[model samples]
Target: MKLYIAEKPSLGRAIAAALPQPQKNQKTHIELANGDVVSWCIGHILAQADPEDYDAELKKWRMENLPIVPEQWQLKPITRTRAQLTVLRKLVKQADEIIHAGDPDREGQLLVDEVIDYFKLSKTKKNNIKRLLISDLNLPAVKRALSSLKANSDFMPLSISALARSRADWLYGINLTRAYTLQGQKTGYHSVLSVGRVQTPLLGLVVRREQEIAAFVSKPYYQVQAHIALTSAEKVAFTAKWQPSENCLPYCDEEGRVLVKALAENVVQRIANQPALVSHIDSTEKQQAAPLPFNLSQLQISAAKQFSMNAKLVLDVCQALYEKHKLITYPRSDCRYLPKEQLKQAKGIINTLANSSLPCNKPAQGADTSLVSKAWNDKQITAHHAIIPTEKSPENSSLNTFEKNIYLLIVRQYLLQFYPAYIYQQTKVHLLIAGGQFLSQAKMEKQLGWQVLFPKSKKAKTVNNSNQKQHESEQEKTLPPLTKGQTLHCQQGELIAKQTSPPQSFTDASLLAAMTGISRYVSDPAIKKVLKETDGLGTDATRAGIIDLLFKRDFLQRQGKAITATEVGVALINALPEMATLPDMTAQWEATLTAISEKKANYLSFMQPLTAIVTEMVQGASQQSFSGLPQVAFKPKRRKKTFTKKVARKTG
Candidate 1:
């Protein structure tokens, strides 16, 4: 019999619907008319065995067993899914042919492959296994995937890469968590001080920001603004900012902020009531394209900023839209670019959106189908394309308020690809007043274009450097027509005193943004380049979960939308080594994983060094003292035990 193994029950049902008719659905497997059967796994049926599984002596946490490296890694069936696994074992033995159906990403590949490995099929049956990759659960998309199947062996490297990642995480997380928790106990802190490859670095980001804010010293700075009246028919008046000359470097701060009030006063005294000559006028038209469609990270950031929704909520809403409602494509996609071939579906999807009762219906109807934005590029496609709306209309779907908001966000971003670029004219006027330089700038919108679809309140606000705040204010004012050599009277010179502000606390939106663009946080150019290439510290699928895990562990706390590290979190970071708290090591590991996926690097080369690093870290942690950490009473919860009485069976 031919067998098809799917990643989940919904996927299994979808696959069955696309097959021949006269299908019989059973609890564990579906039987087709032609002696073919379809089965599935519930996420991952198998999990990595614990350290104690290797040896009984390692059951208790001790510094002597610092780094537990298994010579032969083992897999144990998850208790919750063992029944389904039993059914699969029966089916695998009876099947003459097998098809491996899993999600296209690394985790999905590894989960299904792990089950296949557990069964230990013959070499020929393993070689004969086919692989089915499905990103969209829509009927048409599923049917297309069924027509073309690739050899499962072709994806072995992907499976291996995932295996390497899981093993590395286990080795690193388990060893460090045990080592640190034991050490923390030495100082009367009974909490389980967990450490992870990604979560620790993420917690470090928050803790370091808190430290920086605590250590900040506010200093006063001086600024000079020029109020000038134009010599035109309208007599338009505008504010211009003082531009200090190179000779004033001694009196200025590193960011060019005037530190000496006396020097700023001299400029204010010289420029007042003087005739200012327009030395330079620059006017240039600029066009800004609409932002690319939503990747998981970008979508989370947007939802968090606009609706104050947390990252986990956004991900849950997206999953519902994709799997349950069938209104959108894959939600865990990291790619923001769509395949060129998929662009042909734009008209159908747009029409569906226009006909629906969504908030963006009008804009969807007005979208130009002929105009294709730069988002459609095949070369940029990753494991999956950008999250976009399917041809399915959402009007019939019973969506909740959160689902509707997230769905509309995805649809609007996709529709933006068919809109015109936002056009604006930038005007800059350089004035010379009493031997001092003053500059005025303005931005005039020539065309709103795609910008009209987004409300100004929903737009992301840019935070300017403290030194450039005055200059930014000038750019917001309107400017009149002016030419070189034209003379205008400066009404007055104003000297404003301002104090530098400390960095703002991290909000959900800003924290997710930091994770997505972590390269900006690092100082080393080499590490920054690696991080940029690897797309930061965590995958799009796992970032939300990692952040959520921190909160559940009481390592992070949220105060009205702002996320801050808890005392336990800060103490843990203080106790850990510098390398464990930074993102540089995690970024390098990601690059190596990518190389392994591409078959350019092997698993041993990556694991050996990781093992060595873990060994050194465990050794160092053993010698470290946690006496300085804050003492918090933590009682670990004990699982309730259930006892069942056994009935003796009668011998017949």
Candidate 2:
């Protein structure tokens, strides 16, 4: 019988039931009529041993043997699930072929592969098994995968990547933890010092943001506003403003506050400055096409903004929709489009979902799959298409608020791909001040096009008032039909003072935005250009986890819907080396890993550099530089002698 291993018992049971009427459990393993024997693992049934496991002496803190770099890592049957392992061993031994039917992701791949490698499963030519990967743990996809089973070697690259990532993490995590723990003990610290490659960098991200907030100094600026009566014939009513002189735009005093009084001092400057008059009036019509489909990053961002849901929550909702409800495509996908042949399936999915509780508001009749050209590129899809609803009616109608929003978001965006481009006209009017050195004007907008699709985007999303006003202005304006070159009389005008503000610290959303351009900060234009040509900092699948790592370690905190860093986080990262300071660590890793994925770079090339750098970082952080914070001192210390106690002893 062909052997099938699923990630968990629930999924295994689901797969088994989907097969042709299963025979009663006969022997050691559960057998199915399709000639498939299904078994499962509970997370990790085997893993590498701890440093202390290697030797009894290794358990003690010893700085001399800090870096416990194992020549070849070893694994043992997980103690907690030894009973399940016995069942798995019996099943694999009797099976003719084995199918790695785990969750379709890196962790899943690694976990399943680890089991096969652990027990030395049959590697004979008699075995013709392969991985069965599909978005949801449903019947149709599972049966389809079974009918088309290929050899396991076909997915060697994916298997290799999974192994590498896990091993790399192990190497770094183990050594650093041991090193830091020993270092702490030496400094009279009794607690564990946890260090991880991803965790450290993630903490650094939060810490950097904290520093920006802590050091921020707000500067104020003044504007000269005049209430003016629109001409009688025009019968217009609006406020007017004197163009702040280039020099006096932000008339700052020594303390750097905006000089509101300075504007009053310059009355002559106001009369001479005059109000900004409309010099040019231009109007045109334009349309904004619907946005591209939901890549994981895009989905996370939209969900976060719309429902205050984190990436992990959105991912959880997607998993439920895919696995439990069986009404959505893969959730952890990087691609937002499908291949040409996938159009049929797309139509079917839409039709299927239309009947689901997650029904579409509009008719799905005119969904010309061809019209979604921007989203339809075969080359972009590797593992799965965007997270679209599946053919099955959702069994998850009672989804939480975040889950519902994410599901609705994916559905709306996917449906919009077929919707016709929104049509509208836009208008802009600029007025030139009567007396100013060509620097002041008034402007307005006429029409809103596809902006209607996204009310949030159409409105200014920022908290800043001036920016909000600017967006509101260009979005819509009622201008009395004034032709170009119409000189308007200004009854009143005044000069205003303004000052430039320092850039604001990046928010989590903005941080993700910045990470999209890791190459932007590079000094060498050539390198920067190459980074531009490359993908964003981390893949859609990894960035969310990266941010999660930051939050888990107390580095990042959610303070009233805003992400900020803790003091310990700041101190820890501030002590890091220059290389660790750069967020491009994620990008660089991805670039090299992508090359490895493409076979352009050797595995050693990527591994050696990271290994060397991490070694150096561990050594560097070992030194003490903390202040007003808790840190494990990485060195032994002499016992302190209290002066008061010593004096009492001497007197006695």
lDDT of 1 at 483: 78
Model 2 CA deviation exceeding 4 Å by range: 23-30, 53-57, 121-129, 144-151, 184-190, 222-233, 237-284, 353-359, 363-370, 435-469, 479-486, 494-552, 631-652
lDDT of 1 by residue, 238-345 (tens): 988898899998888888899899999988988877889999999998888888999999999989978999999999999899889988888888889998878778
lDDT of 2 at 147: 75
**Candidate 1 residue runs with Cα over 4 Å from true position:** 232-236, 456-476, 632-652
Among the numbered candidates, top TM-score falls to 1
Q: How well is each residue in 67-94 modelled by candidate 2, as lDDT tens digits?
A: 5655666777767788888888877777
What lDDT would candidate 2 get against the real structure? 0.60
Clashes of 2: 10
- Whole-model lDDT values for every prediction: 0.84, 0.60
